[model samples]
Target: MTADTNTDLDTAQLPPPAEKSARALARARKRRSVARFWREYRTHRSGLWGLAGLILIALIAICAPLLVGADSQSVTDAPGGALEAPSGEFPLGTDQFGRSVLALLVWGARVSLTVGLLAAFLCVAIGTVVGIVAGHFRGWYSTVLMRVTDWFLVMPTLVLAIALATVMSRSIWTVILAIGVTTWPTTARLVRAQTLAVESRPYIERARALGGGHRHIMLRHVLPNVMPLVLAQTTLVISGAILTEATLAFLGLGDPTITSWGGMLQDAREAGAVSAGDWWYLAPPGLAIALVALAFTLCGRAIEAVLNPKLGVAR
Candidate 1:
């Protein structure tokens, strides 16, 4: 029994296996990285505020199912009179259809947030790929790609998006596609500049000398270095995408079946709320849109500051 106890103690005291030790070290490094990120992020007051606002908005969007019911959106089953003023029963007042405006606003957040995130992601994905390829491969091929990007860049993004939206069937996906394709040139330009800077470093030459193929060099070396810039750009793109969605929806190009901020504005216009002086009907959605855009912009600036220390010092 003594020998068994000694053996067990010895086993317990032995160092961990190579794989387990490696995993533990990796986890420790990750924790340190996350801690360092938060510490740096805290120094940016604007970023903190923006993060708070975004969290609040995201939480509200997530909790829509719990906060309100489907009945609030039903025109036929509306509990309030048409264009009623704000009250305890109808907080933000009723719309033209007698549906609760507050409910519509909350529900609208879902669409705006969804479209903004998805469209921005698509835009960044395309831009990152294009930028990496363009930066890594120079010569006539890169020149042609850059010329195509410049063509898209010089054209007014809104006009191009509107043209695309007009051609496609009206739906959130169409809105996303239009915004994604139109807005990517800016990101591509930014990322391409960064990629060029990264690739110019001596490490890239060493990587090439070590038999690293194009795929290996890009994915392993170039991509990770440019990720911070990509992350910062994504926030700005989200704000633009949201605004574009609002524009498209307000112009009656949105899916007629859904409740969105721009759709609410369109409905208000059709209902003559502006002329009727029903400010409650018009204000909520407009304010919400502005706040969301501002929040994202603030967050983007803060992220840029955090990622690039020079910006942080300037602030």
Candidate 2:
């Protein structure tokens, strides 16, 4: 009886197997969530291709001079090389001035991508602040803020951008600023609507009942919930900004000193590539711009699918 009692006491002193099992289960659940996210991302064909294309473009942009072995703007008066089609020496061909078209494209991508990312950041930042303020605080403040947004919404953004660019120096920064400032109204409205919906949730009401400060509720509770929507909108805005910059550049509003995809198109037009049947000059840059825009659109759609799984199968 003494021996049996001692053995029972030792067994009782051991940690609970159930607790160990629960901990292991929790770890498994965490791993499963991570795996699920990756699986969803992998399943998204458009998103995968888009990401691949963007990365390739970025790589080319980063290694432009090294890969192409020429300055984007350096004009070569190689009479024999003018309007040469794609070949071993110039993969994409030579422009009217015998400048390597491949080099121009690589360098131009750098400008387009930079403008897109910077403009999108500025737009998203301004929009988020305006949205949180207007949505979290109702009454006169909301009305005033929304009215201002509405005024921007009604304005002709391209005309306003052209006017601003005309008034300011025709530079990349000016273009970025004009596009970013004009584009924020849409983002602000979307974020505000999201914020209003999040604020009405039961947890938000509880936070209010618990005397949580406005800033606390806005930042901690509201922002995180609405971040997915903001990110999706940002992708679309980035694509729009790129297209806008290209349009501005194509219209001769672009800084002449800067090499851009649109600038290349302008040069092609000036060189009479279309009339002269020099298809090589116009095709490459046009295709690049289209491809980049398509990539962004696809990625954005994929993200939306992942965020809102109820809309369709998980991306």
Worst 10 residues of 1 by lDDT: 306-315
State which candidate has the highest TM-score: 1
Candidate models: Cα lDDT each: 0.91, 0.87
Candidate 1 regions with alpha-carbon error over 4 angstroms = 1-24, 313-315
TM-score, one value per model:
0.92, 0.85
How many angstroms is residue 85 displaced in model 2 relative to the true structure, after the best TM-score fit? 3.4
Candidate 1 backbone clash number? 0
Which lDDT tens digits does candidate 2 get at residues 1-315?
699999999999987999879999999998997788668777899888988998998998888778766545677544237888888877888898788887788889999999989989998989998998999999999999999999999998888888888899988999899888888999999999999999989999999899999989998999989998998888878888888888888888888888898888999999899998888889988898889999998888887787778768434
